[model samples]
Target chain A: MKFGVVTFPGSNCDYDAYAAVRHILKEEVEFLWHKSEDLKGCDVVVLPGGFSYGDYLRAGAIARFSPIMNRVIKFASAGGMVIGICNGFQVLTESGLLPGALIRNTHLRFSCKFVNLKVENNATPYTSACRRGEIIRIPIAHGEGNYYNFVGDIKALEDSGRVVFRYVNSRGEAAIEANPNGSINNIAGIINEEGNVLGMMPHPERAVEDILGSADGLKVFESIRAACASLLNTVGGK
Target chain B: MNNDSKKAVVYVRLKDGVLDPQGITIQKALVQMGYKDFLSVRSGRFFELEIKADSADIDRKVDEICSKLLANPVIEKFEVEKK
Candidate 1:
């Protein structure tokens, strides 16, 4: 499976995600420049973490207007895999590929630390390898990771099982203390209705190695690879 | 004199139910400094835009910018004032 990592100006974690896929996951990976409209036929497109476009108007606000976003939207509309991490998550919401918006942390400070996340749902391609209610430690670094959705849409998201991950404690319980950024309902990650796209604030790529503190994040990448291969086999069998 | 140049101000604010952490922080700091007369606080942003009066439907254009770019309609509300 080919992975495409987008490199927007001010994107710092693009290489990290690229390295994780190419070296660790042993997959073909390419860097998709923000100005270019080509996805290079990648199976999965990753919008990595960073303060894209200096987060000028707002986090991921200006970057959403980049020329490549038009193609990204098209790719996602066709059931292509897309992962938006950190500021990438913000861009997803801004571009209307995902629901809800990320706002300022309730503490109004940049939080950088390892937090626990529970796999709220395991049916989506993104979290297929994760067991429901399993807790994984991942680092989050951002000032605007707080997730906010209206009460009505919140219910719809929950009812649809689109709430993929939530802040949790060591025992795999969603607790108030585990909520690092004050995100509503402690949402750490969510997938769109079609289950082709995932937008999350946690740095899963940053946690792909045990030397980096935890290797729990590797399962996320493995799940995608498994899902992609399964998809190819399903088509080949026809 | 040019007849096309005009000014428009866009005000962007978070919706009522959304929490304004920055504003709440500021309010707390004020209380610590002995200015506790305020009931609540909220934070927002504004932008000054210069547009062409001859452009097709300036109101519609400004509204589009506000909704699509200047303000996040999910958590924010925007107002465009024309002069």
Candidate 2:
């Protein structure tokens, strides 16, 4: 499967996502410039982590207005799979592709470290490879990773089983201290109701290689690659 | 040519119940500096825009921009002032 990584002007993780797909996952991947309003006939689209547009106004706020975002939104509306990581998560929220908003970290500090994320639900295409309650070590580096939504919306997210990943400790417990950012309900990632779009604050692409510290993040990509292949086969597509 | 450009000042602040870590940090700093008699502190952002004079319906235009771009309605509220 082909993966298209959107590259906003200030995006620094484009190459990382590209390398993760090309080398680790052995998939076709290319950089989709922010100004290009095309998906390049890719199976999946990845909004890599970085301070897009220099995090102007707010994290991912300015980058949301990029010319390519229109096409991305259209693609998502058509049920295409899209993944947003770190600042990309912020952009997804800003673009209305995902629910809620990402605000400043509760500690008011740029958190840069590896955090444990437990798979809350393994039903979605992104996490189908992961078993429920399984923990993965991924590096999270962001200053505005705090997720917030209205109380009703939070309840709906839980009721609908859209919360895909939650911050947890080594024991896979969603303890308060384990939450790197003060995301509501310790959310590390979430998927939309349609399940085609995902937004997470951690950099899975950065952790897809053992040499980079951990290869646990590769499971997420592998899950998508395998799922997409099966989906194509079921639909009689190559 | 007349200077028909008008200014619209916008103030964006987090909604009530939403935690403001920056505001909390500032409050802590103030307390450490020996200041007292404070219920709480909140933080916000603002923007100044010079509207073109020929643009009609300034109020609606400003409100649209504020809600759609200047402030995230999910977490923050924005107030626009014509100047």
Candidate 3:
């Protein structure tokens, strides 16, 4: 499957995502500029992490108005696959493709460290390769990763199983200590109702290699590939 | 001489019940510095917009921008004041 990594002004992880897909995953991938409206027929779009638009007005706020996001929003609404990482996650929320908003960390500091995340629900296209309750170590770097939603909305998110991942400790338990950014219910990632889009604060592309400290993040890419291949096969059979 | 420029200020603030870590941190700092009477603090931001004085729909335009770009309605509420 072809992947398109969007490069907004100030996007630093666009290369990381491109490299992960092309060099590691060995998939066809290209960079999509913020000013271009073309997605280049990519099957999946990856909004890589970075301080887009210098985090002006608010993180991901200005970037949401970029010309490229219009296409991304339309593509996602049509059930296309999209994965947003870190600042990308912020953009997703700002674009209204996902619920909730990420606010300042409860501690009010930029936290940069490897944290364990438990698979909350593995049924979505993004986490299909993960086993429920399994813990994987991934690094998080941000000062405003504290995810928030209305209390009722959060309950709905949990009840609908749209919550895809949660912060967890070594034993796969969602504990307060493991909640690095003070996200409500320790939420680390979530998927849209259609399950076509996913937004997560952890940097999976940064953790795709064991040499980079952990290879656990590769499963996310593998899951997407598997899902796409099966989808292609089903269409071919018809 | 004709002056045609007008100014509008938009205040964006986090909704009540939403935790404001920065404000809380400032409150704590105040206590540490012996300003203990300051029990609570809230933080917000404002934007100044210059618009045409002759615009008939200035209010609507400012409100639209406040909702669309200046503030995230989900977590924030914005007030537009014309000056």
Candidate 4:
């Protein structure tokens, strides 16, 4: 499957996503500049992490209006698969592809470290490779990863199993201390209601290599590959 | 050259139920400096915009920008004051 990694003005992790797909996943991937309106026929779109637009006005607020995001929004609405990491997650929330908003960290500091995330729901395409309740270690680096929304919306997200990942301790328990940015219910990631779009604060590309501290993040890409392959086969069979 | 400009100030604050870590930190600092009795604190930001006086429906335009770019409707509310 072809993957498109969007490169916004201040995007620093675009290469990470590109390399992970090209070298590690051995998939067809291309860089989609923010100014370009074309998606280049990519099956999946990856919005990499960085301080897009210098986090001006708000994190991901300005970048949300980039030309490519207009297409990304359309693509997402059409049920295309999209994965957003770190600041990319911020952009997704700002673009309204996902729900809620990421606010300032509860501790009022930038946190960068390896964090354990439990697979809250393995049913979605993003986490299908993960076993339910499995704990995966990934790196999270950000200052405004705190997630917030109305109490009712948060409850709805929980009730519907839209929460894909949750920060948790080593034992796979969601504990207050394990929440790096004070996200509600320790939400490390979530999938949109349609189940095609995913936004997560952790850097899965950064953790895909064993030398980088953890290889567990490869499961996410693997899950996407499996889902896409099955979908193609099902379509081609008809 | 015609110069008829008006300034509008937009203030954005997090919704009441949302947590404001920065505001809480500032409140703590106030207590540390030996100043108590401040029940609570909330932090917010503002933006200043200059619009042409001849612009029609300035309020609507300002409100549009506030909801679209200046503030996130899910977490923040913006107030615009024309001066």
Docking class of 1: high
User: TM-scores of all models?
Assistant: 0.97, 0.97, 0.98, 0.97
Q: Per-residue lDDT for B73 in model 1?
A: 91
- Give the per-residue lDDT of model 2 (tens digit) for B1-83: 34878887899999998889999998888888888766579989789898788898879888888888999988999888778
User: Would you list the C-alpha lDDT of every candidate in the order shown?
Assistant: 0.92, 0.91, 0.93, 0.93
Task: Tell me the tens digit of each residue's lDDT in model 3 across A200-219.
Answer: 99999999999999988988
Model 1: CA > 4 A from native: B1-4
What TM-score does model 2 score on chain A?
Answer: 0.98
Question: Over the stretch B1-83, how does candidate 1's per-residue lDDT look in tens digits?
Answer: 35668988899999988989998998998898899897678889999888776787878878988999999999899988887
Q: Taking the tens digit of each residue's C-alpha lDDT, what string does model 4 give over A55-143?
A: 99899999999999999999999999999999999999999999999999999899999999999999998888999999999999999
Mark the 10 consecutive residues where model 3 chain B has the least summed lDDT.
Answer: B1-10
Question: DockQ for each of the predicted structures, in order?
Answer: 0.92, 0.90, 0.93, 0.92
Q: Supply the global lDDT for candidate 3.
A: 0.93
**Positional deviation of A227 in candidate 2, in angstroms?**
1.7
Instruction: Output candidate 1 Cα RMSD.
Output: 1.6
Model 2 residue pairs with clashes = none
Show model 2 residue runs off by greater than 4 Å: none
Least accurate 10 contiguous residues by lDDT in model 3 chain A: A229-238
Q: Ten-residue segment with the worst summed lDDT in candidate 4 chain A?
A: A229-238
> After aligning candidate 4 to the native by TM-score, how far in Å is the CA of A186 from where it should be?
0.7
